[model samples]
Target: MKYYQKALYDEMTSFYLITCDDEGDKLGRIRSLIGGLVRKARQVIGQEGDDKVRIHQLLQLFYGDWGFHCDPEHYFEAENLYLAYVLETHSGMPVSLGALLLYLADSLKLPLYPVNFPTQLILRAEVDNEVAFIDPWNGHYLSQAHLQKLYEGAFGFGAEISSEELERADVNTLLNRFRQLAKNALIRENRNDAAYRYIASLLRYHPEDPYEIRDRGLVLAQMGCYQAAAEDLQYFVDQCPQDPTSFLLTAQLAELKDHFSELH
Candidate 1:
């Protein structure tokens, strides 16, 4: 299997990798690592119910040596390493390292969740039962105010947000991330056809999202297929009437259609 395909399959079957020995000897090692970690965590926490401390330690044990960055690709590679280690050494499989940490945290009754950053991987921890962002790779704790600053730096003004609003992201969101990476790979390889196919798959998974529609339309436009672009942009406009870009695309399409009509 291709690397990404194997990664996807590993994500899907992560839960069983701990026990399924027929897959490979690596599974046994992963199981042992996870088991050892869990035991150590329980001993350290020792029924004190200090979930946050326990989770922090567990994650540290897994990835404290790694550096921190705001880049999504860096986080992806980190997650891949963490998950692969857990899967091959501890009989642990998490959909991703982020998911694995979330799972382990959950098991420890820690209120930890994945943060859906626009282009980064982050986690939120309920320290003292209050929400806070954490840089798992670097052990940097982010305050709500800091998060707002980060958001402004990344997304800009008028982005509606609140600490309470940033709920736990799900597995599907992580899967979409993988798909985004796949799309990027296609682009890097100059395989627009494959890139378009990946975008179609993304739309299938997130049909109601106008952003995907707009993105797909932009890709179609780049390919010089104005008709297809118009179709997608029209849908995007229909779905997100307030987005100025969609309106602009619609106007561009109208002008193209008129020019084509004149020629015909």
Candidate 2:
């Protein structure tokens, strides 16, 4: 099932009891809040009528109070700030704030799309099919060039990356981001347990990724699970014959009599 479907189902179930008892009042309040928040957001953007402003301007109004902190890791902090602002400034419900923003923008015929970026909760707006990324915390609009520079600094300039790579980041990407976080924590603390959790998460998200399979094999080998490591390495080699690491691991496994030669 799609992630949003599951989320909608859960939401409906939670409010089912309230709806049953006071359907009219419940819906009326929801509509009122949505209408009010939409008007407020539009006013903040200095937009008259339905004319759309840049995505960055929307973000800036959303988080204008917070000073400049552009790091991706500060996403949760930004979310919290927005939540507090909604409650204090607009008398909005916390449970519906994110949904309201998404819905209201659509209602206003805006081009906003929810972005599940790596280690961040953000939104994007498309104009002429080109996406402009929005940071909800400081309300900064991040350009494609900005994203490219950020990736180059982190992953090296030779790394080939594009906005298309970020266009449809789904549950798998979320799992990978969480796994990366766990791996970073492991590196900082030198904890085997943390590393194991990351490996497990990576496998769960991409059971068929050859690189992940090889990584799991390496972890197993380190844990002295030679038999299991051999099996994984054998599978990796079977799936990707061109990988040198897989071939080397397969040869090592063969010496231990755990390699299945026919598989390769």
Candidate 3:
């Protein structure tokens, strides 16, 4: 119960509760899940005072005994965003899986932090003054070369992994990434209403963010909120004139206005 760890736990739990539509005790359920893992992890790590050994055991508990893994086939499934669903199904995309790993690492008193890496969510672990990067999709340790390869894959060849890219992400940063991922997944699945909810939530946290505004506009258009979509798209085009997507949105705005005029 360090202050930062508790704050992160509470924030993540609150976000989970906010996303649920049913009447169940989402907080309690999440607490129970983490509590069970904590107990089991403690049992496995008993008398093993080595931080490295404890980390290995915890990974075994998570990836081996508990069977958490990435589900690549249905990569954009909206259900993969929830911790409860990921815990139950043992499969989730990177963000949810990374969050779960960070939470468990906190409970087990391991020095782990979330890294909001480009196009992936990863963890940074500190053991005995040495740092290691972990791929949360699986509990594999990543070398600087491995991370460089990932960075190049995302940003094209010759891109290098920078210190900023590996910096520890604060809780707010992690939550923002989670919501963005959720929004995109929902949009990909054609669940426009759900996607809109995520966009709205992000907007409340980061008012008038141009990218989110654009995403909101896209979701609104899909849901037939043409006027709102047009307004949002217009705002984005006006604010970010040179953005790569702004030109495309400019065209979309013209078409949207035409469609609106036709209706009128």
Candidate 2, which ten residues in sequence have the lowest lDDT sum? 5-14
lDDT of 3 by residue, 1-264 (tens): 342544344544555565567644665776788788777877887634787887788788888989988977977787777767776788887777776776667767787787889878888888888898888888999999989988899999998887987978766776667666767777877887667766777688779799899999999998888889999999998999999999888888888888888888
Q: Which stretches in model 2 have alpha-carbon errors above 4 Å?
A: 1-58, 61-123, 127-131, 135-139, 144-189, 201-209, 221-227, 244-264
Preferred candidate (lDDT higher): 1 or 2: 1
lDDT (0-100) at residue 156 of candidate 1?
Answer: 88
RMSD of each: 8.8, 10.9, 2.5
The lDDT of each candidate is: 0.57, 0.51, 0.77
Per-residue lDDT tens digits of candidate 1, residues 162-231?
6444666655665566555544544554556645765776567578777777767767766767677778
**Pairs with backbone N, CA or C atoms under 3 Å apart (clashes), candidate 3:** none
Report the C-alpha lDDT of model 2 over 1-264, residue by residue, as the tens digit.
Answer: 323312321232233322133433444454465466567766665444433354455555545532223334432222222222343443222122333445555545566655555435455666776666765444457777776676677678876556566674464453344344434444344444435555665567578887677666666666666677777778888888887776577667775454334334
Runs of candidate 3 exceeding 4 Å displacement: 1-15, 23-27, 46-48
lDDT of 1 at 146: 70
